[model samples]
Target chain A: MNYPNKKKSFQKEVNKANLGMTLESDIDATNRYYLDSGIAVIHKKPTPIQVVNVSYPARNKAKITEAYYKTPSTTDYNGVFKGKYIDFDAKETNSTTSFPLKNIHPHQISHLTSVEKQNGIAFFIIHFKPYNEYYILPIHLLMPLWENQYKEKGRKSIPYAYFKDNLHQIHFSYQPRLDYLKVIQTVFNF
Target chain B: MNYPNKKKSFQKEVNKANLGMTLESDIDATNRYYLDSGIAVIHKKPTPIQVVNVSYPARNKAKITEAYYKTPSTTDYNGVFKGKYIDFDAKETNSTTSFPLKNIHPHQISHLTSVEKQNGIAFFIIHFKPYNEYYILPIHLLMPLWENQYKEKGRKSIPYAYFKDNLHQIHFSYQPRLDYLKVIQTVFNF
Candidate 1:
């Protein structure tokens, strides 16, 4: 959402093959690493899209003529880790003072809350691009901030200090890139 | 994949609103029913696709001009159930005698096996459309059959009697149509 344009320093030219890939790819690479080593079976769900119209240009070639991106029913990333069901989303923001709430949809919050109710480990991997900081913000911390949106006592964004103090810091690594699962191990004792 | 034509009487015109919807919708509806009742948190991953070209016909409108479906990296459906991770695919075969091995891709078997190594529940929901029957086939039974495809001991498709006797039966319901999770209770003991 607003996070991409908020940080000019984080912008970089990406290869054409990864047209729609973003912070999600970094997380995917980490997931792939986890999967290959038999550490976890995690994956990023494909972007849900609704193709309204299509045309057959050739015998086996179909060309999409009309389509629209559909809001997904669940968060982006989900899988199993150490027999625990893990569900989460990864986001990047440039805001130094606070991470905007708009980056997450109301449906996604409710969906994660449902997963939490089922006792699945649910959280968000928030990256402050300006500082190159990544933190595992659990659902427990997200709920209050999200609920505050409907009440008067809540601020519009989560402050950087709140992340620094309450959230688990995820270190950057070369192979796994953002090893948020390592943070999960420390926080959830996996 | 050939199951739909195996039985002719099972064929029926699906409503147009479900343009690309397959037998998987019944599973999705079942998942939604489970989610709404706090019974489980399951979802069918969107079909993966590669968007090649797009045109901005208007200021607020964008149309996809070229796209192709990409093979999914994992199964079509997965989620948390009673705190246990569940991963699977749903198939409808009209065949009364043998279910084709071609319905499932080799990589899916590999993906599910990886999930199984992590102690997650992995299986398939195959509907014998002709008999109007559904069965929850566990990964243990699937692995041998999938592996047999590469060896002399395996047949091309699983026999219908094998499903009727070996796999757990999933009855059709008015509310939770497929109710495959119901069978998960007996097999996984969750």
Candidate 2:
């Protein structure tokens, strides 16, 4: 019921998020609900990290004295849906005008490419926070822009206008808020 | 050229694996080679862990003072192979006669069943290390026995003889040493 800061403004309104959860956490909750109910099996894989040192304080207690987050070798989320393999990454951009290409790394692009070849569903869930908008932009729609970034080296981001015209926009709700899987149904028909 | 101990004997050969680097590390190496060569995309998911406390020693360094291993929600390895979604866990048993049922948990079996319903390739790579044997035994083969464990209160382990008779045996090679994909090719005919 209370956030640390008592300051009231649009910032405070943004902090509430209705049920007091971020878009990412909401997706996580939705996933938990899905898995619990036998609807689907999806999970955000643990971020791969390197542990340099650790000490055992007790038989079961572990104290990691040193550790570092490593560059992930694959996408953040993956699982099966409707008898189809689904893989995706979720991104949030503060910029309301465009989604920065830098947010999508080269390794991730290649990972999606590999998944595509394997007939797995590959896409990005881009959330524009300012407008409270989310879009399920498939790899097919993104690959050309990704390739052109290197070929022409002119534009390094996708304009909001482009997304407005071509994206598979997803609506939010009270429970299972993101409902990107609903968009998956529309996109993949699975 | 050097292992911690230089001792050579059948018993010592078995002791080398107790360091926790035999099957898992080899598979990790195999996956790395596969990714580098653009052969097939597969990865061993990092074990999920719970962090209780953390402190930053510097801008670039983190000190996790407390943490604990968490129950994983899914299998250790999963990825796409030849346009097919694949998922499996690798289990090693010291027992010579049978693989211990306790090596597997109830959640993993349920996870595999869900994957099967979704048309994903689900199986177990059971490595009988003492005998240096590996079998790509699918869920369909293990389920009846698993169910029987509850119904008849029979042996909790699947005998080595049963695996040898029905398992999809694979050979080791210099590169991608286990060559489990080759076994998959034979078993799935892909």
Candidate 3:
């Protein structure tokens, strides 16, 4: 599938925005809009920042250069919709067949496990490469794949056919490119 | 109280470890340790990355620069704790008496408000400068002060006395520098 062209144009649209929003930013804004409109209460988790050396450019301004990425200990996003705790990760894959397990870390899978154990609604919004097709895969389905991969019996990536059949399709709208709450509503009645 | 003069000693410690762990990294490690041990479920959120350009040093390696900070749309940390969703911000302040409201954006406060409304647990881990004393101030308490700050009679920071009396004090331990779950346990019995 020729996904690069469509993905590039989508990237261009995001870059052309005055705010220069990224895919994550757009999703966040859309989530906030959804929250404000009383559609849902969801939020992206903040990136962990480790400020090592801060140069004071001014009294009120500080510049940070020396920093390292910290391993996140929880899922990317979580909140409540109609009294149900919603949890999920927003991931974009360039592969047409499946998202590579490498895109997800063991810690994230564990976090999802914890969320599921707590009876919270957990899933992932995966964007297929070149084709802008987005699908919502439940955490339960992901865990077994992750386990099988770890055990050396599963493929490194989930086939696109599996995604098409098992996952719920999330429609992209002007307001929320990956408006996933609608799928959540269908799955959890929230 | 004046903080101990440990700059030279701490720098020596930093050099001896050969680990360029930032304060954020240390916090993340601590949270991970706690989670792995089943002590608590907490995570530092992923930073919002706006990757405008990516340089491929190697086919598998991509170095990102020329990116800007995207306005965060959610709280920094959140997870499940004994059937409740825990959410909060870990802020370091160099003030002695009070924490500045300016440290938190209006949108973040709104996010916390929404979390509180959903029956999830939300609070802030405020680190007092020099003293290193940390306190967990609930969102419910912070909201009113945040709102009243614009009434022409509002204080810029929450006084230490208010924190001491109302907020739960979190002790800095070796495992979890800002071990706040203990406070949560006391407050919510979880």
Candidate 4:
């Protein structure tokens, strides 16, 4: 665990070689590292799909012919870490100054709210593509902004400065690309 | 929460109306009840599928043309319950005298083992169809039986008497068809 702090300096050099990968892939790599090392058990839930038609091509082989993506009813990723239920969604924004609120579905907000009520750790891994910066925002901090946007007709997006000032930044690394759990260890003090 | 035990007497009458429903649908209904009543936040993960081709017939309406079901890498159900991470899979067997071990996948067993190591509640909801019986088997209890099958070349199935003697039976009710959480509260002492 002490190695988390020591891995910081090599982040930039390692991430430069992985510039072609998407945020989703980086997070997947990070989860794989966590799982393989026995540090945690995290996984990205497969995208939900609605199958309308299926054709049996041969014995014991069925192929789906018609289907559509379904909006997920829960967060993208969830698992157990340090004896706590961990839940979160990963999002990337093209805008340099703000992250659009629409990027987070309402169902996820409701689901995370329920998670928080049960004392599970709920959060977001946000990536600012233009700046190549990553931050972890706990559901508690996001709840106020989420409410204000709907109740008070506040800004539809969260300014980059808000995240910079209020949230914990996640450093990119060689093995676990995003290293959000390192931030979790510090933020949650686990 | 205190109402769990009180609802036991109404089981048979309510379940008779849902005689045609499968075990999966009953679990889904039970989870919905838990969620709506603010008791728990459990969910069954969507079936994983590998999509090969998609065509956009119109803007924002992509239709999948080819896909195949993928084997799941983890348990089917997981979420936060009473601040504890709960993970499990539901299974059914038509055999009258024994529950086949092959009904549970190797990946699911491995995933549940990891969940248990993290202090998460891990178990299975098993239904013996001919008897219309349901039992909750904790991962801790199942682990030895799982290992014995491979190491000692033991019996491939668990006898009906074993479940009736060792596991907690789940009563079927109107609101939550399979009241497995009630058994959890008693078994895990949450």
Q: Residue-wise lDDT of candidate 3 within B49-142, one digit each (tens)?
A: 5544544443333344334456777777777666577788877666677778888888789888887777778788777756767778888878
Worst lDDT run of 10 residues, candidate 3 chain A, spans A54-63
DockQ of 2: 0.46
The candidates, ranked best first by DockQ, are 1, 4, 2, 3
- Per-residue lDDT tens digits for candidate 3, residues A7-78, read 565566565453323557767887878787876678766656444454444333334534444557666677
Candidate 2, CAPRI quality class derived from DockQ: acceptable
Model 1: which residue pairs collide?
B3-B93, B3-B94, B7-B94
Give the per-residue lDDT of model 2 (tens digit) for A1-190.
7544433443555465443247668789878877776777888899776777766555435566666667897898888777677889988788889999998988888898888877888999998888988999898889988878787556889999998998888888876777788889888766
Q: Candidates 1 and 4: which is better by DockQ?
A: 1
- Chain A only: TM-score per candidate: 0.85, 0.86, 0.80, 0.86
What tens-digit string does per-residue lDDT give for candidate 2 at B103-175? 8888889999988887778899988978888899888888988887776668788999999888887676789
Which sections of candidate 4 miss by over 4 Å? Answer: A1-21, A151-153, B1-21, B151-153
TM-score of each: 0.88, 0.85, 0.68, 0.87
Candidate 1 retains true contacts at a fraction of 0.85
DockQ of each: 0.70, 0.46, 0.25, 0.60
Task: Summarize candidate 4's per-residue lDDT along A21-92 as a digit string, tens digits.
Answer: 488789889888888888888888988999999876654566999999998999989999878999999888
Q: Give the Cα error of residue A155 in candidate 1, in Å.
A: 0.9
lDDT per model, in order? 0.82, 0.80, 0.71, 0.87
For residues B1-190, could you state the per-residue lDDT of candidate 1 as single tens digits? 4443522322332342242265667777888899999999998889887988876555445567778878888998899988899999877676779899898888888998998999999988887878888888888888777778778665889999888778788888789887887788899886
* Model 1 ranges off by over 4 Å: A1-22, B1-22
Task: Looking at model 3 chain B, report the run of 10 residues with the lowest lDDT sum.
Answer: B57-66
